[model samples]
Target: MTKWLLPESLADILPAEARRIEELRRKLLDLYRVYGFELVMPPLVEYLESLLTGHGHDLSLRTNKLVDQLSGRTLGVRADMTPQVARIDAHLLNREGVTRLCYCGSVLHAKPMGLLSDRELLQIGAEIFGHAGVEADIQVIELALESVRLAGVEHARLDLNHPGVSRAIIEADPALARNAEDVADLLSTKDVTGLRAFASETPLQAGSLDALIALTQLYGGGEVLQRAREVLPQLPQVGQALADLEQLAGFLSDYEVSFDFADVRSGYGYHSGIVFAIYADGWHDTLVRGGRYDGVGTAFGRARPATGFSLDLRALAGGLAPAEPAKAVRAPWGCDPALSAALRALRAQGIIVVQVLPGQQQSLDEFVFDRELVCEQGQWKVRAIQ
Candidate 1:
């Protein structure tokens, strides 16, 4: 293989795509800032234990591990940044009330999430810590929806789910609880056939089995919540989960919202409350995923209610149209101080300016020179290319 070749599922981002991703990152961080969210940038790697704290097996599986040279301890390239942010809120910031934080950084996945996904992702997100109410979930959901809207995504759909419902049913039966991981995997895939096969193979209580099967069919419009309350076992947690979903849906009248009871795969399993994903037509999978992951901070010695959402900026940009080449003022190679000053002035004004180097042709994929700086009457001036 060529030395410049990247590994499978990893590739260098070229100029046009990189520019689009950068623009999206700036727009999103600015939006988060306008909502009182303070930007925080965590490191790309951390001690394995600290990085994996409060996350589930899925996150661990995605994390790329290595040995630290100095400390001689195991370190991990982060597959997600939510847990790191939680630790910051718990131990570093140590705030007492509601705290809003946003972050944008590169996260490396051990494996591609999908056939077309990359191992490297520019993850950008915002989180609210120290608020347990569904109101916090509502705010986070709204921010997530607005994120895609700002990206010019049309007809985005919000799908909501609560792990509490599935957890309650799974725990109500000893047999199912013993194999929680398998059961969760089955549910997340919404494999009713596999669930029934597992139910038959394992000695699940009739009520739990019925509820589990009911969940597979409990995905649809707003009415799914009501149908869930009627069809599923009347457990306290299930009732509370349904009520939370109802309340969340009620507040989101402007956007299209739906429910998916069997989608218990709340990203990294730290999600302890209402979970959500934003889906649009252009993207093959979810554009954004997040929810309330209360108590995740406890691993860092301070438990706080938290709700947030994150999306891969690269993936989001990949779905959109290619970025247009930036209009630039092309200047010829020269030692004149006036030409240098003119280039600086235009660049300082945020205009794209490309200075041609001596003895070389200028080739750019991201810039199109529509104007040029030339000496006119002993002064450098910009004139439109004819």
Candidate 2:
């Protein structure tokens, strides 16, 4: 018999781990529910046309393509969920001023084999449609931070950056956009020497190059915002982006929060405005990242304002510390029928009621119960139980 082995980057989640992860996800999703973000479940596979409409060519290339036997046309395993949600908002939810959506599902992509990164990644996220204002941005960021806090990270930092910073530099010299692919690689690898070589050959002005180089190092807390402002001058767009982040920082100052205003970039090219990444204790990588993609819905029909964030559930599960097991309740033997009926009623109200028979009932005091009810004289006496 052949051995059963999961493919690379795919895993079989054990029961305990899966249960804990699901419990954590439920807690976070409940928090989202309180904020009015209705949950949605999008199909895992969609037509390539709908999925790849607004996605740039680079993203389309990485998509895993297939033929649909039923329709005799091309279909694609959804590489990401954001575009699919956008498509839904365009076609299904036609009437909208503002919509809040949350989703948790697996997404497939064409990744090199034997790599640790999953071809199928689990994403738990929310998106806001038809709200273009900065308020929407603030709401999304705050909700994302709340999810991180709920996941047991006592101290977490949210780093915010704007794509406009880099876009402005590229627009100043169109040639830079052509060579952006190489530049992105350099920046990702933090290859300053290679970036300098590329900038030397490109048509970008000296001041812009200096600013871009400075951005590569301007990372950290509020101080980084000052450094970025000093280095990148005469760029109104960058200044406005910095101002927006500062305003957000001021707004969230009361919470256990720290801000970073650096020229951060993301893998997705569609991000047009603010982008952010979340870091917490004991994690090797950022647990979540997302940004504003304003033009995302335009290709479908009319464009609508949008911003959202998604958490890498796998990364979150890896970083979460083990939680103590809940104390078990023991059912007492020889329970009276009337007492059992009352116990059932208590359970219906979500009360953890346990019957203590002729054996030791003293142990019940040590356990955590909101109230202790005892059946006496054909009636129940409720006593406050700590």
Candidate 3:
């Protein structure tokens, strides 16, 4: 085995792709700044408890754990930055009003999420804390949609789900509530057969079983909301969840929006209300995922209303067209004052200048030397390459 060979599902980003990812990161961070989201960078690793608090088994399974040599305690590499940002809002900042924060960093997953996914991801996102209303949800969703739009993603589809719909039905039945996790797994997969089997094995009320079966078919365009009202039980919580989805859909009338009640569970169990995932044609899976995860900061001793969205920059860049190589001016290696001044001036003007070193072949993947800087009649000037 070669020492340079990376593990399965782990790969390095070459020059062109890396440049595109960096550019996307800069654009997104700047966009978030315009929306009053202050940037924060949490450490890549932290105590396992701090990293995993409030998030459920899914995040735990994704996080890579190690023992801290200095503190002799277990530590975890973060798989998600949301909880960390929440901690910052609750403990560090302790602000009274709504706090908007944004972050961009790499997160390590214990395993690849899909066949085409990389174990290492460049995660970028924005979060709003201390606001509970649907207004915050609308803001984050718009920001999320705008993110892909800015990246040149056309015809993106937004699939919305509220765990409360399923949660209400399950809570109404003791048997389903007791086995919520197993039930959620089945529903998320849309395994009607598996659901029937599980229901038969467990003691459940007829109404709850019927409702669970009804959820599997409640996925589609805006009409799904109407069908849900007719098919699902008329519980107050279910009514409220449907109303919330209707409100969100109405506000997002400008874009493609749909609903899927069977996607009842979030990747992390912390999401307390409306959950959403964005899908586009080229992408095999969701490009972005987020929603309201209110009270996520309670583990840090202060609970606050929060909503946000995050996407893997690497995954996003992979679907886009390759970036064009940057134009540059080639300069010969020299100690002459005139050559040095020309190089400095071009670079200061944001122009790429590739200085050829002695006995070295000038090769670059991210830049194309379209012009040359030369001394003509004792004056340094740039000329187009012929």
Candidate 4:
């Protein structure tokens, strides 16, 4: 094999794509800053316990572990930045009021999240800590939508779900106790036949079992919320989850928002409350996914309410590549003071100025250089290269 051959799903990002991803990253961070979210950079690796704390078994499996050469202790590469952010909010900064923290970096997962995704992803998102209200979830969702829009992604549909609805039913009933995981899987995939067969022998209440099966079919807009009310028991936990989804749907009136009662993945793992995913045209998987996972900081000490979402910067860029880098103005190396001064001024004004080495033959395609700097009328000026 050639030395340049790389591992599967792990390839170098060439200059063209790298530039777009970097620009999108800057725009998103700027958006976060304007909304009062402070930036935090967690390390790429940490002890297995610290990295996996509070996050569920799924994330733990995704994490890659290695023994430290110095201490002989096992260290794990982070598969998600959320847990690290939670640690910072809980222990390091343990402040009084609400804390808005955002992060961007690469996390190494043992496997690709999906068929097209890479094992190494540039995850970027903002988290809200110390606020348990639906307002926190709403703020995060709005920002997630805005981030996608800014990246030039279109036709995105937001699917909202509350894991609590199905969870509340399972917790409230004792007969369906042992088969919770299996039943949850069935509902998550909306396998109506499997759900019916699984619930038939179980000693669950007839009405409740019906609602559970109905949940598999419950989807679409606000009407699903009303439909959930009719079939599912109005337990406090379940009712609260419904109300939160309803409030969020109303708040985000501008988007293509819809409810997904069968989205067990959103409700599963560490998410204690509402969960959501954004779907867009041409993407095989969810463009972005997040939810309310309160008490994520319990392992650190104080259990603060936290909510945020993250996306792969590379994936977003591939889906929304901006127009070709605007025709650049290339220059040849020279000792002339005026030529050097003009180059500096153009750069300071944010122009893409590519300078070439003296006596070196530079190809126009190399830098997409469509313009050139030359002496015209005894003055250094930029002109279109024919």
lDDT of 2 by residue, 122-190 (tens): 779999998877788889989998898888877887777777776676667667677765666566556
- Model 4, 233-331: lDDT tens digits are 878988998988888888889888898888886435578888899999877788899998888788898898888999888888877744365568989
Q: Local distance difference test, per candidate? A: 0.89, 0.73, 0.92, 0.86
Q: How many residue-pair clashes does candidate 1 contain?
A: 0
Please identify model 2 stretches exceeding 4 Å from their true place.
112-116, 200-204, 255-265, 323-386
The worst-scoring run of ten residues by lDDT in candidate 4 lies at 358-367
Question: Which candidate number has the best lDDT?
Answer: 3
What TM value does model 3 have? Answer: 0.97
Instruction: Name the regions of candidate 4 deviating beyond 4 angstroms.
Output: 174-179, 193-209, 267-269, 321-323, 358-366
Question: Which of 2 and 4 is the better model by lDDT?
Answer: 4
Cα RMSD for candidates in order: 1.3, 5.8, 1.3, 2.4
CA shift of 134, model 3, Å: 1.4
The local distance difference test score of model 1 is 0.89
Off by over 4 Å in 3: none
What does candidate 1's lDDT look like per residue over 286-350, in tens digits?
Answer: 89999888899898999998999999998999899879999999889887888888888889999
Itemize residue pairs with steric clashes in candidate 1. Answer: none
372 Cα displacement, candidate 1 (Å): 1.0
Q: Give residue 341's lDDT in candidate 3 (0 to 100).
A: 93
Question: How far is 171's C-alpha from truth in model 3 (Å)?
Answer: 1.8
